[model samples]
Target: MTVPPEPEDRGTLTISPSVVRKIAQHAADRVDGTTRAERRIAGLGLGTHGASAKVGGEGNDVDPVLDVALHYPAPVRRIVGDLRARVTEEVERITSYQVRDISVTVSALLPDIAPRVR
Candidate 1:
């Protein structure tokens, strides 16, 4: 004979930090004005402009730091504010984890050299 499932509750679901980081990263990527820094390989720089995220969580809580490069003439505060909200919502919704806080770092402010098309 096998045991039946309980209706009220069951076991806990654990979401890892890396998973949360990826969630936050994706959310940040979706936002407009978010740019990534270059990746250098053997003195050769390569990589698309985008954003990177780091997440730390304790138990069911998570906090993330987003590093985004800025394209000149962009609205800074509005961009960061939007990025924070989006990351929080996605992390919580997908992982069912509480987002403690979000810290944003302005990695770089690139000159209006080449405008990227979204």
Candidate 2:
């Protein structure tokens, strides 16, 4: 996807990093059994909850690095494949920026738990 440049007289348009991050996080979350990991060092006191997205590359070509967690009992490979494709498609479609590369890291694996009855 190519982001259209602003008219010469109108000035340039810029996309915010936060926006890109949100897009990536949401896309990753859409995949079944996938959860976004919090931005924190492993074994640190900080809690994990949401994924992170980092956008890079030149011009309209943007690469996104996604950090996430997957629930146990799910097919890891399949979930990752879906995540990569979904994130790339959604980010490109929403931002109109070319997704040159998408890197997915499995930050953690959460165990499946049964719901409590009232």
Candidate 3:
């Protein structure tokens, strides 16, 4: 049998997409009443575990965007609004990159089930 040719290795500096997602998620969760319910956003096709890196552009000069899906216990609209503002703030503060946009998609409105005070 003939030997298969070896695959060429290109030194490409690539970062997984999850990194940006995690950073965005963490920042969003830190918002007073916001929480990241699920790991991944189905429609958006964002993975739970990934990493993102800046390819190259004058050292973080380009604005980055973080798409988010939120699950709230009440007032979906209000919660979504708050999430957008908070995500933008946190990402900008931590990464020092201008937020191109924050798209907040409300996934679900869960009921606030209270626990019994024993």
* Candidates' C-alpha lDDT: 0.83, 0.82, 0.50
Taking the candidates one at a time, how many backbone clashes does each contain?
A: 2, 0, 5
Which ranges in model 1 have alpha carbons more than 4 Å from their true place?
Answer: 1-3, 7-9, 112-118
The candidate 2 region of ten consecutive residues with least summed lDDT is: 36-45
lDDT of 1 by residue, 58-97 (tens): 8888889889887767899999999999998998899889
Steric clash pairs (candidate 2): none
RMSD of each: 3.4, 6.0, 11.3
How does candidate 1 fare on TM-score?
0.82
By the TM-score metric, which is better: model 1 or model 2? 1
lDDT tens per residue, model 3, 1-118: 9776655553444333344456666665555544344355666745342112221223343333434433344565676577667766865576665566555544444445578895
Report residue 108 deviation for candidate 3 (angstroms).
1.2
lDDT for position 62 in model 3 = 30
Each prediction's TM-score against the native? 0.82, 0.76, 0.49
Q: Which candidate is the best by TM-score?
A: 1
Backbone clash total, candidate 1: 2
Better of 1 and 2 by lDDT: 1
